[model samples]
Target: MTDWDQTDDVGLMLKKVRGIASDRQLMFFACGCCRLVESKLPAVRYLADRFEKDAERPMSRDEKWSILSAIGSALLGDIHPILRQFLMGQDNDSWTMAAQVASIGRMFEFNGAPESLEAAGPSIPRNSASQAQVLREVVRNPDRNIEFDPRWRTDAVRGIAAAIVESRAWDRLPILADALQDAGCEDDELLQHCRLADHLHRPGCWALEYVRETPERSSPNPGDPV
Candidate 1:
């Protein structure tokens, strides 16, 4: 259903994004996805402006490229720009998926980059506080397995994405893979989304040589300007 319903959610919104044929509609749905996931991180400000402009007009090839680049960069906490090499190998579907996952990851990092936890290693650092936050967002008499806030799901998803990229060295993509293999995950699309996150997180090993290790700035605290 269209976002006009207000009942439209992240899953519904993403599917709508993939099917949209008009540039205006695509921009609208894409921005709606970002809004739904709370992608208010400062890194996406340029992007928010870009889409805001597009919401009123059509995008040029360069503008679309900039949008995708921003999404990829934001996923890495605005650290790494999207390298030409990564985009060179992708088709439309592949890159679109990358953009969507990056959007979610950005929201997850809204509080900050979680730099200390990342430095500890490839774990998600999803503390009890994160889980508790999800529980609180839950509604009464919900379906058997209702989704938590999209922002809340990011803890595990972000770690899984990082692990997917880190796992390339071992000739395996565990975390999400093992979950899917053991029938622990119900959504087939989630694995691919995490893989896209992994790709955006690091792109390739050569990226490690450069691309500043930490984001230039942490997310703004409450009351700080966007």
Candidate 2:
């Protein structure tokens, strides 16, 4: 078994994470240790373990926030109930929650798992309509700061595109197309749209066309106005 205390860097810590006991306390401790290490790999691995263990052992609000704090701005795909739990808590840290929400929203986009969103909130029915509403709120919320992490912008765009297409918001298709062309989205993100478009049976989709026509832009220009 891997030794948690001896694990110094992320690579070694990840190996230790698998060896941590399955109980909530151990999981929480591992998560805390992972955060102390301050490495993205450990944080991600810790989150993955917590998410899986959460299935059998429900985490308290404090534990949830602890995990969220460690996950800070990391790309945790899909709408996890843990995120909703964090949001509903009394932390009053809106920025952190927004970042978490944005990450979860991106996950939903990549996986197209509306069920996960439904799982987050029992009140919100698990269906395409409800999922669409949540996605719209996150994407359109001016206060949410969806673009806080530039590395995640492509994920956010892909999520928005998925929601638009999945919701059959045909009226928004042109708008999404325009955004894709102007936003200078990454190739992987554009490819996600192409796959989604094909699955939706919408041939020659605007997103795919945009991907085909536009060359990848170089690193974002700081001087360029948004």
Candidate 3:
């Protein structure tokens, strides 16, 4: 009974989605959260891209751990405590980690102050609002099966989706939607999601995943392509 469209509290959304969302969904959400401050911290885009690529390629547990460890190490020194908490608190579930990253982005968005969580309390609502929208885009209607016609995955559709995913050029989503239409796609939900100018479309985006034929797995493996 969560009012997804109305609720802007990402913490609430994360609680609802924790057990149900796949690793791919959570990773996508995490990247989307980090993307909130990519302009201010250009390194965020690089990290997000690295994460997305790592998620898609198949890897052993050790490999996955190593990659995350390297990333965590790279983030050390002169970083915000929230981000430090995110990387060091490995025991946290993906939902909590993503929320922490969002908090870091909120900090960068304002003053890049290394404010403690308690000190950053005043902006929690605004931070949640931004992240909740990302969670919505990645998890839109878990109960509803948005059927996509396999025939719609034509060369143009796949190419557009791949380019969008690789470049993070979400502005081209409408053009992809147009290509889908040319391929006779009539799914309103899918079409509208593509054409949503205000929506943040990251790699592993639900619509792009559909077009790229990388559906969310019940038990996703990092070695498995996203």
- Against the reference, the lDDT scores of all candidates come to 0.36, 0.37, 0.68
lDDT of 3: 0.68
Clashes of 1: 0
Best by TM-score: 3
Q: Per-residue lDDT for 1-226 in model 3, tens only? A: 4476678766767666666676567667767766776766666677777877877776554554444443333333245656566567676444445556565555666656556756666754453577777887888666566777889999999999888877779999999999999999998888988988734666667888778876465454333334
- Candidate 1 whole-model C-alpha lDDT, 0 to 1: 0.36
Tell me the lDDT of model 1 at 160: 49
TM-score of every model? 0.34, 0.21, 0.71
Q: Which is better, 1 or 2, measured by TM-score?
A: 1
Model 3, stretches more than 4 Å misplaced?
38-45, 53-56, 59-77, 80-90, 107-127, 167-169, 218-226
RMSD of 3: 5.0
The 10-residue segment of model 3 with minimum total lDDT is: 68-77
TM-score of 1: 0.34
